[model samples]
Target chain A: MDTIIQCENITHYYGQKMIYEHLNFEVARGKILGLLGKNGTGKTTIINILTGYLKPRAGICRIFGEAMERLSPAAKSRIGLLLEGHVQHAYFNIEQIEKFYSRFFPQWKREAYYELLKKLQVTPVQKISTMSCGQRSQVALGLLFAQDPDLLILDDFSMGLDPGYRRLFVEYLKEYITAENKTVFLTSHIIQDMELLIDDCIILDFGRILLHEPTSYILERFRRFRFDSDAPAFPANDILRNTERIGTHWETYSFASAAEVERELVKNGATVSRLSEDKLSLEDAFIGLTGKY
Target chain B: MYTSLFYKEWIKARKLLLLLLVVFAAAVAYTLLTTIKQFHANPVAFWEFIVENNSIRTGYMRYLPLGAGILLAIVQLTPEMHNRRLKLTLHLPLDESKILCSMSGFGLALLSGLFILSGTALLLGLRIYFCPEIVYSDFIASLPWWMGGFTAYLLTVWICLEPVWKQRIFNAIPALCCISLFYTKALPGAYVPLLPWLTVLMTAGFFFPFYSAIRFKHGVQ
Candidate 1:
């Protein structure tokens, strides 16, 4: 698999607040890579850097093998970006927007854009500003779909989407990725949908990467273990990345297997009244990994 | 592609363009109508008034172009700035410089077209009502006002493109001061002496949006 996106030593700061320090990551060609994190955890900043909207304080962010800040016209033509808030020219209606954008890209497929537009119950003359949030998002999506670039960099696709719209978006995206096998770099706080869609994921919190792994690997290997004790006894070990106790139930999140957790707890002299394995849902895993603390 | 992009920009500003042209034409017609009415009522008195004073009699009409230029910039650039649509525009496969130039070029071209039409109307109105001597002198006096419009549009672009409030204010001060240079009391061609230098400044200021754009791209406030 060839690398399509690469970031090395990406350190950024807004005034005195540091967002990332020596951050590094990569996305392989033809893979849906999700940059998942809590709010204000620098996910959008990374997107901005990659899209050349912002030059980072110090870093090398390459998209399609070219530095993003100075992206070549050819390099730029190959990436379709769905900006946050689905920003589009509010003055343009469906037909006008299609007519407008079609001239910019050589391979623009008007049919591809209209196919998505057909899904919306909007008139050809309806301006984007007048459309509902979901409809506007669809328009933004339709434009990018028509562009048909090799890389799709979508920033927070589910931001203002309702459950139904979000689900529909995810479903469409899943099909699009599968059908096209194009590289995708997306960010979202909505983890459940991301879990279903992303091939690989990077979980970030507080300007640090908590984990970077394939979705299957993390789901199969990483888990939360519950240990109950009559008294307050919370044991910490190198294997457990995070620990939290609510009432008599002491929960431990770790990459270690259930057997390893049980062994570690026994070795630490923590008496366990009840022990059970609870597979961490992606959101739960995000919470557990970042910790409730 | 360039033509399409230009067309997109034209659509954004077309309504405002129509409004500015109507208002501008109306101002010219109003001046001409009132002067004609006065000429009909008392040709000797009005003619003597113009001949003796040798001043352009359009009072508040002089400020029309300046206001039109500022408002046109607002109509053209404000939405893009407000909702981050500039980011969408800058993302196009074309060079950012080309896009910026085309967008600004569209605004400047429309402004100049309307300003020129108004100038011609004023000249024609004066020509139809008065002799060449008065027409030439009066037209010369009004050129500063037209030039003021160009300065206002250029300055407003500078202010609109700036993302930071303080920086906009900072830029506006010099812009306001620069625009004032075009408004000093003088005969119609009084600006002829200073026009060359002012054009140099205005041309330099014309590219101020690009500076703001580069800063905006770097995420600088």
Candidate 2:
């Protein structure tokens, strides 16, 4: 794989609280990698580290073979960053903002930006601060597209978008990235959108990465198994990631085969008369790996 | 790149700049008109007061430059701190210090322009009624206060750029102390001997904002 972003032995903390320790990951070129985690699992922290906003306690983050802290101006031009809340120069109107950013990037695509802006149907004089959250998102996205960077690090792209705008953003971003083969590292609260956009995902639990795999791999193998249990207690084991019991019915999640799960349940002294396995979406797989807590 | 950065700053603070300009004009006009009216009413008494008291009639203008500096810094920098929007600026394909320099440079440059305009207008207006010695003394007397404007603007940038609230408040203490130095000797020609020191402080003030910018970049909060 042609690596675009690499982090080695990254350890970070806030005050005395460790956000993550010895965490490592790499993003390959031309791949969309979704960072899925709960609210405080350091997803944004990773974005900050990758973008050179935050320095990890003990690690080196390099993009395009250059340390993030020392990325050259030329190297920086190759990477586009979308901050949380879709922040841009809100004081500028759509036209003025475009004009302002165009000077920095030699290869700025004016049409690429305007095309996205057209979909928003905002007038040329519409200041970004006056626009709705969804409209602001489109403007931010438009700037990124115009920049046409080789790597895009987007933190929580679906932050405040309505369903229609979210879908529009996803579809537009997908078409653009696919057409240009751009590498993307993004996170979002909305997992369904992640399912539609990310080619691979890194599911982070507290202080550790639980799973890093392709979206298809998790969707294909990870599953939810529901079974009936007359016994009051269900034993904890590595095979079943998480288990919940309601009355006599027990629902569990695992990546194991149905037969192995059934055998394990029987050996665990549970009266499992029936066992059913249901395929999981990305969100389901995310919850299964990280648990529903 | 510098032009674009300046353009962005211009757009952000243009309205405030216009307002500040109006205020500067009004202040200069008011001071000159009041001086004219008082001098016309009692030319001999006013002349005696000017010569014996060694006081220029521009006391009301003492805080105008300082106010301009503060307002300009607030208008220019407050939005950049909002929602951590400075990250977008630092992320630009330029050296972080260079970017910050351009930003602070723009604000300082605007303040410089306004100060020059008002200062020159006051001098020319004073020239109409006073001798070279008196006008020169008054201009010299006002230098420290104008220097305060620059220092205040820089200090405010330092405060606004600091990512940590505690550190921001800490920064303001020394800033206030430094600003107090400019006001300590307000008499005509008192600051003449201190111009060298004030220049040194103003030079240091130019770079003070970078400390906060670095902290912000490191995610010090």
Please write out the lDDT profile of model 1 over residues A104-208, one tens digit for every residue.
898998998899888789999999889988999889888888999899999999889999989988888888888999999999878998998998989988877
B1-221 per-residue lDDT for model 2 (tens digits): 99999999999889999998999999999999999999999999999989886766788789887888888888988999999999898888999889989999999999999999989999999999888889988888888999999999998998889998899899989999998898885557877989999999988998889888888878898
lDDT of 1 by residue, B29-69 (tens): 89888888888999889878887768648755788888988
Error of 1 at B76 (Å): 1.2
- State TM-scores per candidate: 0.96, 0.98
Could you tell me which residue pairs clash in candidate 2?
Answer: none
Q: Against the correct fold, how does model 1 do in TM-score?
A: 0.96
Point out where model 2 deviates above 4 Å. none
| Candidate 2: residue B89 Cα off by (Å) | 0.5
Q: Candidate 2's C-alpha lDDT?
A: 0.90
